[model samples]
Target: MEAKKNPRVDIYRLKNVFFNFGLMISISVVFAVFQYKTYENATVLDLGSLNKTTNEIIEIPPTTQPPPPPPKIQLPKIIEVANEELILEDLDLKLDIEMNEDTKIEQVTFEEDLETEPPEEEADKIFMIVEQDAAPVGGIKAFYAYVGDQLTDNYPTAAARMNIEGVVYIQFVVEKDGSITQVQAVKGIGGGCDELAIEVVKNSPKWNPAKQRGRAVRSRKVIPIRFILRQK
Candidate 1:
């Protein structure tokens, strides 16, 4: 016979009261653990060690060196020399040189010009009269004498006019009738002198015919016609 409980204080009311009481105990315990952890982790900060870091050194392999250059080439020298043995020695040899010397005189025959000549033996040996009568002097003198007067007269006037001084050698052939057949100047002294010499010979009179043995013959003669312009 307990005292009579209030009707309002039932099982439902007891359950609510117990649940609220447990919740309050659990919250208080969590708040205490957080405050203990924060207090244990607290420390002082060092500003000098804030920017510091560690440095490491690494080594690499070394490179190789290059080789040296090659040497230069040299040329040989040339020298000139003359051979003396070939120049001084003689190669050819000869024998048998006969020399004859006379000490004594034997005989000397002097022939004179025989006048009234002997009778010719051969027909070709005869001196024809016509050739003998034509140009008695058959040499170069005869040619000059025959043309001298003509040259002297004709060339003086021309030579004085031209003032040429030289000797012109004229070669001409005399005909059997004692006249100059052809005349040519072998040497000239220019300035109209050579032409004057030819003119002189061409104007010459008939000459004495030359004779070979007994026959008349034509002969060649060389005459030197001089043209000298006198200096006043």
Candidate 2:
């Protein structure tokens, strides 16, 4: 019989495996002991004192602060206006008041339009008709001569060119002060003669004013201004 082959000859090569398995078993045993073992040194806390109540009852008082006041708005101090009855209401006070002296102000009076009244001298200033009619500064012939000479530049060329021959009647207010004013055409001969006649009369010099009861007065004067053209 050959020497009995050592069947466990390779067991030495697996010795590291056995060693690792032994290390795992030791770790497992330590974990099992730590998980199952009880310690006598644990401190026990009693919660019975938390449930116990004293005889005193706590009471919370209601809030004592008042609500805040409304915000204030800043406005202009003085406001001026035309004469009118203005009612002012004071928001801070409960009453409506008028502006016065004790609240400190002066008196005010109303006035009328000054232009409506005229002076005494100008009261009988204008009259449409008087006792004596107003005359030009010169006699009738001299007045026509002056009119023709003054109207040399403002001649009715349109009427002359068209051979318009007719008389233009003009009306005017000869003022009390001998001034010729308010000259207007009564009956017009067209073709520019109407406006020309009126314009010529408007530029006439002062006249001898009309007389009413021995006093110089305004008078309505009507005159026939001729616009005769010569045939060429």
Q: Give Cα distance to truth, residue 199, candidate 2, Å.
A: 1.1
Model 1 worst lDDT window (10 residues): 123-132
Candidate number with greatest lDDT: 2
Off by over 4 Å in 1: 1-153, 156-162
TM-score of 2: 0.44
Model 2 misplacement above 4 A: 1-129, 150-153
Best by TM-score: 2
lDDT of 2 by residue, 55-83 (tens): 89889899889888888988878978789
Model 2 lDDT vs. the true structure? 0.79
Q: Which lDDT tens digits does candidate 1 get at residues 164-206?
A: 6889988777675667766899999887888888888777766
